[model samples]
Target: MSGAYLEMRNITKTFYGVKALDDVNLSIKKNEIHALVGENGAGKSTLMNILSGVYPYGTYSGKIILDGQECIFKDIKDSERHGIAIIHQELALIPYLSIAENIFLGNEQASKGIIDWNKTILKADKILEKVGLREASDILVTNISVGKQQLVEIAKALAKEAKLIIFDEPTAALNEEESDNLLNLLLTLQESGVTSILISHKLNEVENVADSITILRDGKTIETLEKDVDDISEGRIIKGMVGRDIVDRYPKRDIDIGDIVFEVKDWTVCHPLQDDREIIKNVSFNLRRGEILGFAGLMGAGRTELAMSIFGKSYGSNISGHIYKAGKEIHLNNTTEAINNGIAYLTEDRKNYGLILINDIKDNITLTKLDKVAKKNIIDHNKEYVVAEEYRKKMNIKSSSVNQTVASLSGGNQQKVVLSKWIFAQPDILILDEPTRGIDVGAKYEIYTIMNKLVAEGKSIILISSELPELLGMCDRIYILNEGEIIEEVDRSRATQEYIMGCIMEHSKEGKK
Candidate 1:
């Protein structure tokens, strides 16, 4: 244990009498990529926060030994000063500020109340090159792509002289290429003698890059497997995380797809800020009753743009589209009109656009369909509680009670609340955008089962996902989108990962020509 670079002994944290981490123990080797994995609410984040001083030393019961010395970190700065840095899933950078400024936000290059801009830029340039980011240090963070933003986060850590770096779900938002680049960067960092701890749900990436793996379940350490010694498989890791063997990743559904229930024809939308730039280009698609239709694409392929523009024009401008329900054309100029006309959209960004974090689950569940629990604009508290409780049980949302704030719930449970709200609205056509993002395998299966039930009840679904396997397993038919246009459509029997990717590549090459 003395030879280990970092060690946490008997780490325990609680929230409102609930134990988040119960006497957890972890050991990390020097200059190795260690992976921490678990289901939602499994204390992965809790442990990392304690290590990085987000929760502070006094708030948690633990002995953090760094480089053979017991360290007590009072704040994030304290940990940073000790060569510890953390990069969260959400990149923490000021959008309007230059990369150089963001890298040294608090620890700026200043002397006697005067900032040295040249020094900051030069230092940032050196770190950015280390992280393989080619963008100029003076470039604004807002203008860079998400992939570059990830690199910027790592560069910031390097600037802090971090010897031990932790990344929480770094690849969750990135596409395949971006994810590969980030994972490779972690390996590169490891080769350069920097120790890394990656917490992710993507088992494939973990297996690829992790030198050792630690599994947590229900706030307790289950097991730690060394990649070189143990038979580390995705199935083994999943069983340790969920406490059961999931025979099937997707639930079986009785396919009984009916006639077309919703159709969009020659739909086109221009960018909101750039008038002449098209975001969705003459896209045409249809959803049949009792079927899940999936849209597959790489990042920025306009799947979200098409869904949002159709749902009361929530995105883009200069929209031109023809939407039909049950063979009758409908006009929806706003979100209210779209909802009233039996259209519901579940946004990918559940925290920002989907849920009211500060509000209780009951309030959020019944927010979309207030009329159901109200009489003449007056809400009945008793009825609302009953409705919320019903959905809580139905969705299997793990919380203390329906009155629990949405912010306090896990990512999976929060997504369930969003689904409950939309289901209560009684929409005929539901657009689910990245419905299972950032959740565990078990949670993903639960969501897939919910989709099956919804379609079984004759409700059509428009699913948009970046995961090719998810689309393949869940959709009856898959549409490939590239550069804001639909390139090909394939039936479930014909859609393979290779076929879908091939379509995208073919179309991309044509677009370039």
Candidate 2:
């Protein structure tokens, strides 16, 4: 391979006359961990798609050079033959298949129309060892955790003899320890002389591992910063990304604490399939008017179960809970009743539960409350259009028009549409579960601003997040849940990452006793 491993020169791509990438140039050296950062819709994914042959050679104007030779990639298979592999943000693994089968799904171990199962298992074992995964080769991919699935992806790439691997938001769903392990694996790959192009929204992780950083804004290349030569700090990177300095990530708000507005008592939920196994245990909490109460916990700790159970029992089976609004008991048997009772839940899995991807922004925005746009069972198209446009602008959704399909929009914009759908319902209490899971920092700041604005208008928010720093920054009070139970509650002024974790550990030890 040449000293400069790959280069894309003057790449320009357009979609339906819209310039998705305009005169973008990028170069990467061999064995370096290069990072790409930008706001949503800034052409990061578009550039990578072109490189990986998702967009074929003639579809876009660009010159791709690898190992000092110009190349034309016809499809993803062509790029793979040239030692290129991409692991997307959403993993592409079949759940029912075993680890060995998943690793060699297309390129199987076969000889003369006969498959060699033994060879496949043996080879998969070796590849998994290279990726530092110790799982059995025959274990089903569905049975493994997300972090292990990520390693399996890397192992698959290595099986293809990939010299250059691209990771697109690989740690978006992983917890802190899982993220650390994945980053360390990247370092190990670098030591083995593998080149990596990391596309991530987490600025801190980028700053931690990247040898060089490239910034993109609005389909154009901003600048590339070398770690040893440039500033390369998180703040410096943010300026290059958003084109301006953001003074604070979390918006400032005055505390106007009011009386208790919503409460749940003795809430318990059982697993949907395993009826006897309790997923949530007798949890009680209260939210005041204009308050942002946060639930912090590790993965599978039942934070989501608690939120869903309270939101009309959308998740669990055999649920038992007493919900009170202004100290009066109320019953919410279904989702419509929950909304009618002034409660809205923005689910964590937006693509699955929170949005109808085939629908347009206007349809999604008015989905929860179509009655507002109708008079005597007759729809008002003009009124709907105006309302959708107003929210499209208010949420700063980056789309060509409100008629654009939700699936065509970026992750952040899709999230904004979900928020708009619920906010239009005018709920007194909003439950947001991991509201900023896969979006960029600029978009995260915008969401935080919206949260501040909502609470300022006397709306209560129940935020369930795996991110401790976020809870500490934006919440008025924080509750730590461990093993399906609330272990401790801490005020925002007194909550720290160390302290919350300490409480969980203490509770775990006592439970063991």
Candidate 3:
């Protein structure tokens, strides 16, 4: 066997008296794309955190060897001194700063404490060219699309002269084409002798680019599979991560469709920052009882804008809409009003919008419906605990206890808490926006099962998703939106992924005119 460029042996970490990593081990070859896969809360991130020096050297009991030398890093910078760079999922770029400025924010081109603008721009432009980004380095980070911003992040890593780059859910926010581009870039980087450790829930992407796959489960190493030796498949990897075979990715719903329970008419919303720009244009839709109605569009297709505006005008300005519930027109002036009127919205940006990170699981679960656990405006602590515990068990949220902080939980468990919050509110119409964005396949199936359960109980659902396969699998009918307009409506029988993509493309072109 070839000597590994990086090796972590028998690593263990603890937080708040809980073992986050239990004698974990990892080995990566030089200039190879290595994938790390696991269920949420399976300790994938924790292991990576140790390697990145986020936890520092002494905090975790481990032996890290790079290039046959025993290494100890006290902090991130110490690791970076050895040419290690980690690009986070949420993106660390300052939005107001120029792309060049962001790329060299800390690692600046300077001589004797004096800034070198010419060198900075020249070096930044060269890095951009290397990454195949066509945008000028002077462009503000905010002015560029997310895909372009990702390239800037790569440029930032390149600036550090990194040999080993770690990418954590890098393509989670990107579109399909953008994801493909990023994967191709990773492959290209491999040819240039840049080693990578990819942490992602997207299994297909892992299969495509990874030369070796490492499966972690319950804070321990499960197995490592080499691409050329082991028969690597999504199913095989999933079975390793989950410890069982998943016969179905999407659960079957046997509920009967009922009469219209909620309806929207002539909904028009202007951008909050730019009043002249309409975010949602004359959008009309209805959800039937016991039905999963879908809204499909690419990024910035006004699907999220329409959902937010309809749910008590949470987004946009100058909104005009007629919302009806059970044949009676009702006005929802705010989020509370929307909830009281039998409507609930699950925000796509779960960390920023859907959750209060500092609070514990129990508190966050019952946060939306404190009234249900209260008597005479006084919260019943016992009742609140009971309710939270019930949802925790029901949602199968993997946590130490209900008292554990939501922030400390994994992304999948955190999402469950959010779902529990809204589900506790007991709204008739649930607008789920990207319900399974970055969760693992096991978690996705569980969520899909929950969706089925909700619809079977005669509830109405409006699913807004960027993934066409998800829309096709779970939705009864789909509405395709383009440039703030619903250009096409497809029934379940006719809603293939190809058909949906074609509709989106065709409508988007016409919208540009």
Candidate ranking (TM-score, best to worst): 1, 3, 2
List, residue by residue over 21-58, the lDDT tens digit for candidate 3.
Answer: 89999999998999999999888888877777887998
Model 2 lDDT-worst window of ten: 1-10
| Residues 149-177 of candidate 2: C-alpha lDDT, one tens digit per residue | 99999998998999999999999889899
In order of appearance, the predictions have TM-scores of 0.98, 0.97, 0.98
Q: What is the lDDT of residue 314 in candidate 2?
A: 87
Task: List lDDT for all candidates, in order.
Answer: 0.93, 0.93, 0.90
Residue 164's lDDT in candidate 2:
92
TM-score-better candidate, 1 vs 2? 1
Error of 1 at 479 (Å): 1.0
Alpha carbon lDDT of residue 154, candidate 2? Answer: 92
Whole-model lDDT, model 1 = 0.93
Q: Let me know the TM-score candidate 3 reaches against the reference structure.
A: 0.98
lDDT of 2 at 146: 95
